[model samples]
Target: MRITTLAKNYFFYCVLILTLFGQNGFVYSQCPTVTNTAQSFCDTQSPTIASLQAVDNGGGIKWYATATSNTQLTNSTVLINGEDYFVDDNTGNCGPRQSVTVTIYSAPTGANFQGVCVTSLSQATPSNPQFVINGNNLQWYTTPNGGTALSPTAILTDNTIYYISQTNPDTGCQTSRLSVFVNVGLVPTPLGSAVQEFCNIPGSPPTVGDLVASGNNNWYLTSAFGIPLDLSTPLVNGQFYYATTVDPPCESSIRLEVLVNLYEPNDAGSNGNRSICVNEIATTIPFDLFNLLGGTPDNTGVWSGPILTTNGFQGTLDVSTMTLLGSPYVFTYTVSSALCANDTSTVTITILGLPTATVSVSPTPSCSGSPATFTFTGTPNATVTYNINGGANQTITLNGTGTATLTGTYTANTTVNIVSVAS
Candidate 1:
């Protein structure tokens, strides 16, 4: 029984020693190993509590603002810049905890850009940075995160979203939270000008052409005041046309204006014909070309005839000196419209010569002694017929004296009838 009691006591003392040694082993182990390093973050970034925990990472962690403190850090605690944090792995109050530095910096900020245009993507470049946020270092990039670096003097040539960062010149750190959007503007290129013609006829519809703009460019028409015109279909004539170029995703546009002229097509008046007497041209009646041919007051015409007929723009023509006592004569009067290439309408004037007739009898009623003479007067060398004593008609031709004489004997109460006709 004495040996059994001594063995049991020895075993209890050994277990007690082992338990005390085990508990103090980690507590006194070389001031809790810690290898914390400095970290930087954006002011807008929400850091997790785990971020505040030391890399030493063992046992219950405690954080403090000073080297020694009774207050502990909750998981919901927020971290800030220029703040010193102390960490400890021990479960109770202790000294010598790991330390981590926290830094908070601001991201770059700027407004959107516009009116940058280019033909290709390779030529794209960002304009000078307009940083709304100020920092130690300024830098631009092609993307929101990481991409090609852009120079401060880079010329923006196309539509793009460029990223910029503001480093805390003190810390040499930057963030890519801010961006500036640039747009490509339309090119102000004129399609050129041309003339279009339509006759005075009807059934003319609105006109439009696709040559105004190239592929992928939408074409639109507008008035001088920049009022939008119909684009679902064709365009109209006689209207001042202005071609406005529009490109998508671009807040700006360019204009190419073209002029359109509408005029009345030339359709000369119908050919005119009229009769006139010799030396009887002057008339009170005035000829109005506008009322005569339904043309504008600006119509012009030329009269070509004998005696150097007057050729003037006047509507009425004086045919007095243009005609003479002769056979049918032709006087051409050509008139042109304002819109015609030349005058294609002509007016003809015809004149007739005067005819004369006369009758005379000599040695009146001499009974069978001598043949009574009957005379007929008419145009030179004209033919005249006279009937005597109701007998068969006798015909005679006027000689150079413009008179025709017929000889006949009176049988009983002589009766004669004389008439003249032009040859």
Candidate 2:
């Protein structure tokens, strides 16, 4: 019985020792916990096998190309993007290997560029994108690589080659330099006087092409930055225009201001037609021909046509000397100017003859205290004034047939005479 008990205790002791330390006879712990299973890096960083080991929380990390491979990778071995690597820890004992994936991102690329004018380069702004490239965090450089970035307010030199690059914000990777050949052009100078004058026309007005300029001129409504005006743009009087000389894509930065002046001369007034009585002509004073002209005529105009006794251009007509009564005479006034055509207007005047009448008395042999009737005949619709024996004068209006009558109780043998008549 004693021998059997000792044998059972020895068996239990061996089983306990086997359970405490596995068949390798060493204490074991759980497989190394991968704190970061996947890693990312930029190509510029150039990660290596040692870089993967640095992240292992448990020390003594070993790296391999494949999960099942026994061959180990050296610490200096370079890592590749999108490749799987295996890592395990042997700090206390060997642990199950864990798979790791490395992702290496490439740098940003540069975009296309074009030539610009020197003036544009000098006045470039963020809104005015003269120099352009395609990427994030774009930077301009003097050299192809490893140089200080050009400042935003840097003064760019003309006819110089510039390098450009961009950096990736995600991985902090910078791209390779791209060559930008800057072809800076010079602005052309303008020549000629600023002020220009033109004559005013009725239908067709002056255009931009009509203005005098020295070289290949481009016109604009504004002095600065705007599209060139077409040659057909009508010029306005007292308005200003800008002129520039163009050198292909480049134009003069300083514009020449052109003040447009359109001039027009005064013209003769409108025509006039008038009538005058022959009796009043003898007492009429000589009057200016300008007074006869209608509208607002210039006083310096010359007069022509009929009935000018003196001074000709500015003279008046002497109606008393005119023999032909009831005749129409037309007088013309002409105005002239330096750059404008002559303007002419006419005035017509007609003279009317005096009216005539004959009187007859009814009951010519009437006795005293008897009523008397005096009848008159003259031109159609003529007015007459008469007196009975030089007494109070009486007036009467004639009928359409130029006949009128006066009734009065006059003394016997009284004489009645017609004083005046009019039509």
Candidate 3:
């Protein structure tokens, strides 16, 4: 009985020793060990690839601590797309007390192959960037010039002008646009001047050009209008002319203007009498004409000559015929020109045998905005009273030894009646 008890005790002691020393015999700890907690898979064409870990749980006489080894990869295995590979826990770093799971998944594929082609890679200002292929939807990222897919189609007019600028981090600069150039296939038309005034002179009609038109066609002028231009008429100032289109697309319109000039006439000089007889003497009266038109008037007339000293015309005509003793006669001399139609002057000489003041009252000419002046000359100490339209409004009386001058302005078209008296 004593031997039996001792043997049982020895057996229990042996089991305890084995349990303690079994764990400590191995230098490394008895923990599940994997080559790495995480890893990145390299981009490769291979379908499948595998890896491994090594570990030891126990031995015959001692419990070996957990041990790990460097990961080993297997490239020969067939890699299924979109599939995962689970490592065997028992055959790897997994211990009897602990187990580890490693998940493996296939990587995504590369971008679709769109042949190297030129594309408008731009995001126009005031317009978003967009990309389209034959008007089809596509996915692209933001590029240096714009984003991957351009938004809002660009309005291209000239098909020949195909240029795109781009920037990239890896590539300092580039223009990866395709070789095919986009053609808008249209040109812009030019514009012509429009006339402000119209003229009736056919020969000297003001000329205007092609007004602006749409499309790429060239422009020209024509006589398509039924009313032909009066080529014989001289284009006067303040006249407007029109032009008809003569191009392939006919019936267009244009205009032109002719500017006019305003001129002031020379005042009549003082004369001794309306009639002179026998050896009557005549003196040349000095006259001053203010050309206010800012230029010298053309004195191309039988009785008109240039002043030679200033912007004025000077001339003298013999009126001795009217002053001759011949039956008391009256004569009138007229001076005019075509260049300045509104500017004309007349001088009247009357051979009065007695003292008579012909007080004639008539309505003044109607002018839009011209100044009017009234004066009395050729009389010795003449006193005069004038009434407009015989009304009290605008009536004046003046007494002077020489010529009396009075001037006033008109705002609009006006009519005036004048009553001249000499006493």
On lDDT, the candidate that comes out on top is: 2
* Candidate 3 local lDDT, residue 330: 25
Give, for candidate 2, the lowest lDDT window spanning 10 residues.
Answer: 119-128
Candidates in order, TM-scores: namely 0.40, 0.41, 0.22
What is the per-residue lDDT of model 1 for residues 311-374, given as tens digits with 9 covering 90 to 100?
Answer: 2644455455554554344444465554444445545556656556677778787565557877
RMSD of every candidate to native, in Å, equals: 13.0, 15.1, 23.3
Give the alpha carbon lDDT tens digit for every residue of 1-423 in model 3.
Answer: 999999999999999999788755452354434454332222222333433233433421111212333343354555443333333233343333322233322222222221111122232211322112321122222332344443335443322323233332222323233222332222222233443333223333433322232332322223223464444434434434443333332223432222333233422322222333233434423323322112343453223321122322443334444443444332222234443333334333344332212232123537545666655443444444454444564423344554556665554533344444443
Which ten contiguous residues of candidate 1 have the minimum total lDDT? 284-293
Q: Give the C-alpha lDDT of model 3.
A: 0.35
> Of models 1 and 2, which has the larger lDDT?
2
Residue 400's lDDT within candidate 1 is: 83
Regions of candidate 1 where Cα sits further than 4 Å from its true position: 1-138, 141-153, 159-170, 173-183, 187-227, 231-245, 249-268, 275-311, 315-344, 349-423
Q: Pick the candidate with the highest TM-score.
A: 2
For model 2, what is the C-alpha lDDT against the true structure? 0.72
